[model samples]
Target: MVLEREILPYFQWLLGGEGLGLGALPQFGLVMLGLALLALIGSYLFAAARYGPLGGGDLVFQTVSSGFREMWEISPRRIWALARLAVKEAWRRRVVVALLVFFVILLFASWFLRTDHQDPAKLYISFVSTATTYLVLGIALLLSAFSLPSDFKTKTIYTVVTKPVRAGEIILGRIIGFSLVGTALLAVMALCSYVFVNRSLDHSHQVEEQSLRHDSLGGEVLGYQGRTTLDASHRHDVQLNNENNGQALGNHGHSHSITARGDGHVVSAAEGIMRARVPRWGKLKFKDRQGVEKELGVNVGNEWTYRSFIEGNTQGAAIWTFEEINESLDPAGEGLKIGLIVRVFRTHKGIIGEAIGGAFQVRNPETGVQSELTFFDAQDAKISEITIPRKLVGTDNSELDLFKDLASNGRLEIVVQCLQRGQYFGFAQPDCYLRLPEGSATWNYVKVYLSIWVQMVIVTSIGVAASAVLSGPVAMMLTVSFVVLGFFREFFVGVATGTEYGGGPVESLVRLITQMNVISPLEAGASTSLIKGVDAVLQSLMLSVAQVLPDFSAFSTANFAAFGFSVPTDRVLQDLTTCLAYVAGLAVIGYFLLRTREVAK
Candidate 1:
């Protein structure tokens, strides 16, 4: 899969420093413990100032001992019963109204979505997945954030408090109930979206009889070529032999399978139009015009620098080093199928609209033995496919086996270069790949939905934790702020660490006021010293908050289904682990918060 943002594998992510990894658990625990101690000290100071030192000490001891006691005394039966009650309460509140809201939004959604889009599958997938995600998360936020608070408002919580139900159980019960409700809604939405997208994109073109041409000399009937009638705002060029069988060429990222009919063939959409393309990706590095190896290629003047360009016609080339390229990668022995999403850029559009020439070369990493250049016209914004046969004629015109000569120790380097001197080819790490056997598109869709589900659970957990201590509106706002901040946590972390050029929040603000560029150094003085001093404290606070907030963006895999790539299993596992961690941590925190509240007591 082409990862726009890099993600670590399960083990690496679990044990790494980035995000809420298990390796950082000890440090996080220490931080939590330190905060707890600070809170205890703060309470004692307030109590001592009002009462006495001995009285303050006694109160702190009671609070600590009771909080632990309340948590430990949780009964499974009581928890389940409370969960059911919360579920009933949610139903009574008509949470399923969320589904109606979704349906109503979707009813008028067609006004914005264009049926004639070139990539209908992508557009539809993105729309449905994004819509479902926001709707479900919004429901979770409202339901979880307001459930306990509303109970308190109505004094309904007093009845439960008078019963054997503990404060800890209430928090856990609310989380479980809200999660169950959200899960049911998510499943329904996923099903509806599946049907909706398929219905909207499903279309077939009729054979244009007048457009058909027969290759006949005299009376002999030969093959025929024709154009298909317009359907879904597009048409296709088609050809068939006397047997009345042929495939339609690909257009709009899809092709048609012509079913032979009496007079002409009926065109049907091909299976791969919406498929899970399992691709074996390789690590990409660039060789400069001077033939020096580098991590990145030239940055073409694009605002989005996801793709880098290489100078054409020179020794400059974008190379992918593929590891684990064995006979298994090509079990059929037909060849290794290479797929490319090329970004063609031009210094000048020489012929107004002409494809630039590009070439591919495979080299043995160990022996430096390279294959002869395989050339093709590089079209802009199109996926190009090429097959490398098992047998090959090398640049020296010597016979060679693709496996034996080119791939050394299962490592092969494929170089892509723009053949036109004035032209350039842009590539990201995921832009080129070795196509493997396709996986089930259904399973891929399920995985993306699973990602959305994890996100919902996380949001609900955050809201519940906040609501345990704050009012409903405040809790909702806090949850929303956390989610929004989570999206930019990495950048926030960067600023906190002084890695970003403009510095921290205050320093950046100063830069904005002075109209100074990020690269310039601020003039050193007491004002600057004071600015730095204040920014340091702010940075420290930002860093702490960044670590606690969930990285919500990591849970989105809708792009996987849209791009036709199967979602990576490791990422799903990583997300699941992250969600469970948040749920567990927040449950503990919420339990303590609820225990301190008068309503719960």
Candidate 2:
């Protein structure tokens, strides 16, 4: 439900084959290499102007030789000593007080974080993760930006420079030291956040014995239906049988155990309410009212085109072709769980506040034979689940097994149709998926924090690199500006690639002055040609900048966790690799910057 689009694996996303796939590394390396070459040529030209041609060559050779020598002869012990000193210095600066602040916020968090919230888990996780991210990133930026600059300001850097400590060592030492501190802070906070979210969402319910009613057919008792005692401001509608009296419907993101207590049912073990449901996504296609296959369905006049609409009381339906069906999908031998999140768009006021009715049925892809419809009511944007019985009834009233008769040759076609007139069902490809199984909720929460940590690493590196050549306040400004730009990296790409409206910056300004629509082209003339020419150049520059920016959107995975979906392992690996690459590049850049900076030379 959180994922509106199908996620390609990391390798596929980066156009790499497999394993620790090369993602943006090829292009990133080329850019860095080009910049390094430019820096070398520029340094040599500056030296020549200042110290004559022959002396310039000597200076250049000495700089390059010393750089290589320092790299090869770097001492880990010396770096560790300096890193330990940094840790002591940070303690002296009262960095540990940030954790106290985090604790205080958690203590008072319940005042605003309502326990009765419809999705308590999502609310708690969002608040905790967001608060922790801002706190940690703020601490990192402030600490790293001021650390080296303050040493230089107090002339304490002179003491360290007198020793054999290499410029590279100083930079790496500071990065590692601050990273360790941030890691410690993050770990404690992660544990506390985990506890806070779980505790805030923790509650249990008991079965309401008085509410039990017999589910009987032909004067025989089949099962019992009842309601659970209210807890956490909500109750569950339960259905159970005496044979295996443990199954119950999920009410608040989880289901409770309903066991037979003598003649009565007992509901207990309210576990796994906030869960990560592993889903196997299928390929989505559309069928028009005339029953013709199409690539996409009708767009129902919405600006955000994430979901397409299927008209009601017609042949319009969304078809999902699921492949590689196997017994593992139904390991318990129970029916397959079909999870759906759909949006109901109503044009008629018939039966106000009632949910729209929709039908789901499976078809054989090869034989085109379809099963009888399974109906469920859908509310707007609400997630509904239905279990397709192991034995399905065909349209011809023949009982057919789900695996053998309908799901032909390991492929299953599920069709979704809206039954009411003047109502529409809108859904994206990810709106419907077969729920496979659940993973650890705690593990999923940790993955969310892992993403936050990567972001912290990136911000800290930016701060340190900027501080290498800039004053504390100015470096803070630079890092902040970079982070702001990073958050809008997608928007920048959109404009640069002309996917979004309003052309390039120059063209946008032109449109603003003339009050022209973003979609409209500039009026043809000599002046327009000149404007467009400048825009073209600007677009290329914009693209180059966009490619270099940190992808902040990709680093955030709260939605996936919040909506009870497992974050892909490849995504985590790709982000960690990206963080490492950024750190390595920043460390090198910081070394060179300090080498040529005023404090050193």
Candidate 3:
């Protein structure tokens, strides 16, 4: 799904040892060792060329050995003192200006943000998350990139370097101090954003039984109006089910599904405007057009290559096997709530927004009895839900308990198939799942913010490391360039691995010059061969570069929070580990650069 070729290179490298019980630490250690060896070899060659072979050996060894020893010789007192100095300098430089700017942006955001969107909660969360990320990153980059360079320009770095502080200590102190300030700023901004969103979205409408129009059966209400108004321009139209429990819709672009309270007449809307389902993920299998069972669906025409599609009107079907059925987990007891976000590709559109029909089937594994397929109209590119009842009558007119009779050894199998002749259903693993009860939105919000902080840590560390060797402007430029490159690291890897079209950078340039498309083969000639050769070299270099850069996309949890999904613990740990590894490598590089630099000179 999602073009594993593009994203999996990094994930595979990082998570490969997950099953080996080593985690990413072993892979990280190996990489660090390789870098260390490369640096040592480069140093040896340079020394040998500059000085007669053996003359610079002692110099190289001393530098390497001393740097290694000095890494552990850090004094907490000296580091703390430098940290305090760094904080004081940051204050003097008016770093608080960034925080003030953040507040101003947040205060004026309501004027620009559309609160009447269909999912205003998603919009608000996305806006706040994006805005906070950009602001925090900007502040981190500025403070970290300019601090040491500014000190060097004013010859103030000599005051600290002259003391008993190691070069490593200076780097560490600066990182910690700057990170502390950034973290504090982020925490404050996050809290304010949370409060702002809550206040803006806090709304309720009055529902009276007399205002509702009942159906002929008198069990359901058709069109019901709420008395209370919201947002100055909108009122709610409430719809009640047979038990007088259902949903209410607001004209200003929001709706709420309700549940029955103590009495059937007394109903209340579900808690929280932003809520997500905790899914009991099941293992997926497939049946091909030949009715042969397979592990996955056939890949359809998608340039991005993210999802697989099941052929409609064919024997092809996607089956999900679920185990460990715990009825206690579900308070409804009505059935299993299944949520789906299916993408439809219509070969022929009879009418616009015309839904393709699909069917869901439940089979009894022990008795070989199956229920008649329940038909549902499938809308493309939107979330839809269905309920599978705990009790159902089989084809033989025998009643089956879903948990006791149909399910074998706590396992239940569900089959999904498209019924339309030409329409197709495209989906990935996460497209469909069982909808469990919602978790705390506030906790999810905090998790996303934490992810942003991890990103800040990475940017700040790289900035400080660059500043150790380069001048102020150059260091800033370098750090910024690395950040931009990190954002597209996966793309670079794709090109390098030949997964992306046009081969690599050189081939891409040639294609652009020659007005050739990606699918078109390069003409056979000396020029084409030369271009291909150069691209191979470039791809090698790009691959090496990608290995060192952080996978910035992995640290992004905005989508998860905005879409109301809990950020998985495994994902969080993976990103944090990757960030720390990059920081460690940068720290070592900074130490070496600072140790060799003649600051006083």
Candidate 4:
């Protein structure tokens, strides 16, 4: 029952909102991809700062040096030479080699660290965008700090200062060269990731389309195992036939006890209950394959059983069972033998064993008058008996759960029979039948789509991102930490909200005992926003914080997908934009800062 708001409606908005047709463009995943690409580029620039001739100082020096040379109308060759010197000098540093080696190792390792997941679109896009930013940023910082410090130590600035080349050119050129190289590497990685993601998305789209080819219908099906129980007040209708001398029984809502004596006819206390049964030897109508009508002959027989009463010393009452007889008998003779059979199985009174020996008629409770069906033969056994509800009969052996074209097949033909008293019998019970038709139920797609992707993207993005910024040792440490954190963000958040120290005793204990803990510091980060107000500020900060490591919360859309909800494309775009903007922005700013700072020579 989770609504769109629960998973952040990005997909909902992108898929053309609720109930809208699929958009021409797959907006949400695309938007996220765009932002991820942007971030990838930003991270690349930051990484490239190491291998080039210029350093951070080159920006200021390049502007001044270039401006002066322009005024003097110096040759373009001289300007090019100066730029080349800056790049060559920077590349000669051991720090540049070390940084490039580190980046290349990470980039290559990423290729082998494949996930077993079937869907790779979100996972691939998320990993590349996040991992590149973090790696490039760290490399940029290391190169900037290491190379600049060496330049100072070796007094290299003094030599460069004597030349026409300005300090800014040295710094800015270093930044540009490193940026160019790193960005190129990242662009390749991003392209590969994009291809992987699109393949996954395309596969997902095909699956959905394939499923829509057929329709599903649902309805109530009575899975009667032997028998079905009904409430005491339950009632059913019985059809009457004039040719069979059929009379609907149990019509007046009166309860009756039927007893079969050593007699040919059944006696009933309530005339209404006794009259409902149709004579077994009667003409029945059914349809043949060519839509033609046919008649079935039913024969009734009387067998004796007893209704045993447990309340008053286990009294026995007579009951009868009717069996159908089939023979080539004349139509006129059928009337003399045709009659209904009533069998009683359950009763409020007690239990039954055999047929009664002598009783033939019974006094009605309503009229206080006697009603009779036959004479007592005295030779039938005097068996124990109990009054019970009458039984209905049907073949009920269909292979399928639902009946096909039930109405068109015509009404079902069967006799109502129950074992009452000591004899096998039939009572005026309602006829049994069934019908099957097409029907529908509602399904939700928003939640289904949202739950799946939300968790996937959120977990993979944050996990890889955290791995990027840390040292080889620290990266592994952060990877494990972020993986757990990503999986249990809400649980950790709740702990943070309720704990005295805002995180938990675990965090507090760790702080007191050691510098390290299982929960990530980045867990406290917020998500970003697209709006433009105080709310937007809060949202932006939240989004930025959420991306601090790699929030995989968005990929939890699997649950929604299971529920058959459609995800909108826009929401994915928003998330991607927010994440990419933050990461890339951070990387770019880090790059700019790195370009200004001097690196060790």
Each model's number of backbone clashes?
Answer: 0, 0, 0, 139
Off by over 4 Å in 1: 17-62, 65-73, 213-223, 499-502, 510-525
Per-prediction TM-score:
0.92, 0.89, 0.87, 0.25
> 1 or 4, which is superior by lDDT?
1
lDDT of 2 by residue, 1-601 (tens): 5565445676665554556465466767777887788778998999999999889879888987888788888899998988888788888989989999999999999888876777777788788888988899888899889988999899999888788898889888888888888888999999998888877787777777788788888998888887888888888888877453855677666778877777666666657656787777898999888889888888888998888889999999999999988677888888878888889888887696777899989999998888999888986776777788889889999988888887759999999999999989998888888987778878988898899899888888888888988999999998887788788888888888878898888889988998999987778999888988898898898887776689876688887777778887877887888899888888888888888866645
Q: What do the candidate models score in CA lDDT, each in turn?
A: 0.84, 0.83, 0.76, 0.34
Q: Which 10 consecutive residues of model 3 have the lowest summed lDDT?
A: 1-10
Alpha-carbon lDDT of model 3? 0.76
> What global local distance difference test value does model 4 have?
0.34
On TM-score, the candidate that comes out on top is 1
Give the better candidate number (1 or 3) by lDDT.
1
lDDT of 1 at 467: 95
For model 1 the local lDDT of residue 83 reads: 80
Q: Give the TM-score of candidate 3.
A: 0.87
Candidate with maximal lDDT: 1
What TM-score should be assigned to candidate 1? 0.92
**How would the candidate models be sorted by lDDT, starting from the highest?**
1, 2, 3, 4
lDDT of 2: 0.83
Model 2: residues with Cα > 4 Å off, grouped in runs: 4-6, 13-23, 48-62, 206-230, 240-248, 258-269, 396-399, 405-408, 506-537, 598-601
Q: Which residue pairs in model 2 clash with each other?
A: none
RMSD to the true structure for each prediction, in A, is: 3.0, 3.3, 4.2, 28.5
